[model samples]
Target: MEQDTLDLAHISLRPFQLSDADDVMVWATDERVTKFCSWEPYTSKHAAVDFILNITTKFLWCRAICIGDRAIGSVSVQSYSGDDKARAKAAEIGYILGSKYWGKGIATKVVKQVVEMAFVDLPDLVRLEALVDVENVGSQRVLEKAGFQREGILRKFLFLKGKSRDMVMFSVLSDEIGA
Candidate 1:
């Protein structure tokens, strides 16, 4: 499936462009930003841009979250997760914003919009999950605020920041996501 650029009346969601690399690198590659994430800090701008483009190209739906015009970060909902792939009716939501934009409620708001898009725009999708690091309390709150219920913990589900880490799973089904 091809990636579709989604729009939210005020905050537009589009594919990542090469120009976003410099600014994205400044924040996304910081140790503080990737501290609890499942990946290491990128050393160069090309790495960041290529990473975004590579993932965005494969997913059916991915968004470069934008505020006004600047691409502030990314929000992606893949067609399915490992176990959910057999269900053929679920998607997993993941996102990241630069550190400067943290605590602004922007991530929560954008995530809410993505939830709405999944339930309203996609007819076949039944649910969406947010896989957040167990230690990322702030992000867990964001998922909760966005209406995703805590499903459970994924034990040693991902190797991030040099070691295996657990993840708290949150999910919102189609029927539960209000339009």
Candidate 2:
């Protein structure tokens, strides 16, 4: 199907299930989808199972991006837990989509839903942010279209994929929504 004709209304987010390992592999094995992600492309279904069984349970908020109940990707919000008072009010958002689903506007729709849902679901959260690799223009556009403000770059802030990368910080404050 054509990108423009793809009905984004079909997109939805739900908790990851152990049964999603096969679907998780759809994007988990695609380097194109993991290029800007911190983790490398998964090489086995066991890794996907481990992610679903162990990793997904650790996030403050994590969900599978589904289309009519089929997992295509994931989105999550991670909070700085413990006694860090300064960081307690803030959390970071992250997401990934299968390479086959790119350019379909599925991500932007999912992101917008997550943002609205996150603020409500996590009431203590006053700020939700995302850091995008400078070279990942597509993701940057996704965040921008989802209403996040582009903050300045953090030069050499993160060392990922064997190199120090400059990252663009994007954020949406709770007060900024429905304002």
lDDT of 1 by residue, 1-179 (tens): 01133334556688788877776787677888778766688898778877777857877688788866677778887786556557678888888887767777778889988888877777988978878889899999999998989999999999865788898989999988654
Give a tens-digit lDDT track for model 2, residues 15-101.
999889999999999988999989999999999999999999899889999988889999999998678888999999999999888
What's the lDDT for candidate 1?
0.79
TM-score of each: 0.85, 0.96
Tell me the whole-model lDDT of each prediction, alpha carbons only: 0.79, 0.93
Candidate 2: misplaced stretches above 4 Å? 1-4
Candidate 2 backbone clash number: 0
Best by lDDT: 2
Where's the lowest-lDDT run of ten residues in candidate 1?
1-10
RMSD of each: 6.1, 1.3
- Could you tell me which 10 consecutive residues in candidate 2 have the lowest summed lDDT? 1-10
Model 1 pairs in collision: none
